[model samples]
Target chain A: MRLPRARGPLTERLVACLQRPPRSHVALARTDGRDAADDALALWILHELHYRGFEDVDDAWEWAPSLMSMRHHLERELEERLRAEYSRSEGSRSGQAGGDEDVVAVLHQLIEADDGPSLADHLLRDGTTEQACQLLRQRSVYHLKEADPTAWVVPRVVGRAKAALMEIQYDEYGAGHHDRVHQDLFAHGLAAAGLSADYGHYVDEARLPILEQNNALSLFGLQRRLRGAALGHFAAFEATSSLPSRTLARALRRLGLPDEMAAYYDEHVEADAAHEQVALRDVCAVLVADEPHLREDVLFGAWACLELEARTARDLLDHWAAA
Target chain B: MAVEEPDVRPAGDGPLRCRPCPGGPLLVRGAAQVQGDDGTWHDTTRPVTAVCRCGASALRPWCDGTHKVLSQRGVNPIE
Candidate 1:
């Protein structure tokens, strides 16, 4: 819950300024835009204020104009970069099929086109204990607060979409049972695996790609204008989760981890299988059906989700390979 | 002497519905239990549950999303 160690000059300046009062005139360092690690860390810190504020930092800083301006600058850069990359890869692809096309089929084709290597497959087949723990540490950054990003969309939607999203979220929130909350289940899994189960425990150790992944979810969720993208990202996530989660659960059991750890994955196997249908058919399909203009943004969000995940997967795999 | 009761309850005035997805599972939106091939009943735990239609699921009576993979790989299990 404390401010994490600074990754670069930007974060250093941001953290130091955060130590002071919100209204105090503290000058922030200019970012060179080349140090992505520093940029991502700074953005992550700013986003964290909206989630759970750091222990010694005043809550008023969450809305401080200077900080808000800096956040906007960083978000613009991130959004531009994501769109550029999307366009680069999207050029050779076919044109956007209209609202009349089956959105669910388009989503499936998008998923199938993702030729990224499977990190889950490696883990399931022959991952070592150290490798398993490394994955858990990195994944803790997002899994600890799972489903919260998409929860932001509930208020932004209406009618069939809202009702369907709530139905899926109800299960994610444990369906009226405290113990069944997905985030708590991951926390329990972490504890059983001998890792620190505290929220934000692994934020300090997170790499740039991991931070960017978290920032992307926050970016899509926090902005009301990006509601279509948020649902798209959520749909892509659920579509990809079930099978990978099954593999992950098998890897956990193979590593001889505690039953609770594996049980978390087991829960996702069936849960996400159903969620995939609801997210794509009921949520995204219905939303686009009502608001035809958002179809492209929805597709962009889905593409961005897979692209960011592929980058993170490759980063982890390359690191493990080099070691 | 004790009276025996049947497992089936009379249909009540509830809005329970079962909708089958093409090439996928049957989505049931209420309190329901699926009797497996082994004769064991599995209770639905979520707000909506996917009852496996493609028999290729690892989790019996519940869809594990294997049908998508199968369909993509040219297996065409549903058809």
Candidate 2:
């Protein structure tokens, strides 16, 4: 995909540097820019280097120390903010388990306690066709490349956890059927709905919350120290996907969207049912059983996943309402 | 038109176990084809497939996570 339009000064400068030949020290203007949409955009662009470098940009820039430092600066802020929010919500270490409780049980408790707004419910009930399409565009940023971030963690673990993580990922990658790859399925859904199926087509249109959601996943997956959080996020993500997918399917049909689009959600209804179990029991539980020390990090990641998703949902819903 | 069955191989030429997940569906592993309630053969496409134990599932023979919804209303299909 071509480079997206720069959102602000940070992305503007970063994009300019990326267009040039790979250099050791392309100085970037310093800014805290915490919670700024531009900050998220710059970080997303930096993370994109590790995934798929832009066509116009030199691939060698992916490892440039100058860009890496900017990425570190932004990630530090995002991680601190996420941890602070997690701590505030947790309020007194009473909710923190000391690796004694079953990790799956703890994950379930967190899932059950999540009283976040449901975007699927809104769409199924009363959301407009325009709103539905808008949400799909925002979601395409990640759905177009689903299950990839977590795949990064596979090499970082061993034993049953390694085997189990692969099992879940195999299904996500379409269980040996290229036609059934989840990302392609989503791309088909987007095309059938008259939206752009090209990867990163919607990044320029995606809101800050959407960008943050994507950034957090990449952060957890890239850091070996955050592998526990990666698996935690994976388990939480799967556990919550199935039923919402059902509602989403119904809403897509209700709004007279294409069957291929609805079918994507339909596929998730069955796939995630199986995935949730393996992710929770086989992957997260087995990993915790082996490491034990990563349990808290697991919980932290799970909470981050749920909280960011909730924020995304609320932001979109509120935007639609006010519009 | 001729139709051929999907190429699938079980881990071994031995019996495979259907491991039940507490509060969820039965997980069958090591390769097999499941016969749906409608008597159609469905190949095990993934490393593990969660066969629906809860009759409320929208997808027969495959769990659609309806069990979690059931559990909310005091139904434990896993039991």
- Candidate 2 lDDT by residue in tens digits, A134-229: 999999999988999998999999999999899889988988899999999999999999999999999989998999999999999988999998
Model 2 residue pairs with clashes: none
TM-score per model over all chains: 0.94, 0.94
Of candidate 1 chain A, the 10-residue stretch with the lowest lDDT total is: A90-99
Off by over 4 Å in 1: A29-33, A95-100, B1-14
lDDT of 1 at A75: 91
Question: After aligning candidate 2 to the native by TM-score, how far in Å is the CA of A140 from where it should be?
Answer: 0.7
**Which runs in model 2 stand beyond 4 Å of their true positions?**
A31-35, A91-99, B1-15, B38-41
Cand 2, B chain, TM: 0.73
Candidate 1 per-residue lDDT, tens place, B20-55, comes to: 777777777777667776777666778888778777
